[model samples]
Target: MKALVTVMPKAGVLDPQGKAIGHALSSLGFAGVADVRAGKVIELELAETDPAKAKAAAEEMARKLLANTVIESFRVEVV
Candidate 1:
């Protein structure tokens, strides 16, 4: 099985990197941009064959180490 993990900062958290990217986009002539959020994607290959198991394992991994639970949120997609 293949899993994709997306980690992003929770709402209300200050995102300096996202702000910088938004500013740069406006400066580069992409106008009307209101906000931007930066996040990371992780791809994983697992031996589990069931989609449910793969998703559960990936979510556990995110909770344990992949994401900082206090300030960040994670979504897992099993493929």
Candidate 2:
């Protein structure tokens, strides 16, 4: 099984990198680009074969270390 975890800055958190990307896009002639939020994606290969188990494990990893609970949130998808 494979677990794909996506971690992103929570609402109200300062994302300087995201802001910078947005500015760059606007300068490059991308019109009407309002905002951009940066995030990270982690792909994990697991020994478990079941999707449910892989998803649960991925969620636990996110809660424990992948995401900073105070300022970030994570979503898990198993394939």
- Which one is best on lDDT? 1
Candidate 1 per-residue lDDT over residues 1-79, each given as its tens digit: 9999999999999999999999999999999999999999999999999999999999999999999989999999998
Model 1 residue 39 CA deviation (Å) reads 0.7
Q: State the displacement of the C-alpha of residue 41, model 1, in Å, after optimal TM-score superposition.
A: 0.7
Q: Per-prediction TM-score, please?
A: 0.97, 0.95
Candidate 2 shows a clash count of: 0
By summed lDDT, the worst window of 10 consecutive residues in model 1 runs over 65-74
lDDT of 2 by residue, 19-61 (tens): 9999999989999988899999999999999888889999999
Which residue pairs in candidate 2 have backbone atoms (N, alpha carbon, C) closer than 3 angstroms, thus clashing? Answer: none
User: Which candidate achieves the best TM-score against the true structure?
Assistant: 1
Candidate 1, pairs of clashing residues = none
Measured with C-alpha atoms, the lDDT of residue 37 in candidate 2 is: 96
Deviation (Å) of 8 in candidate 1: 0.8
Candidate 2 wrong stretches, greater than 4 Å = none
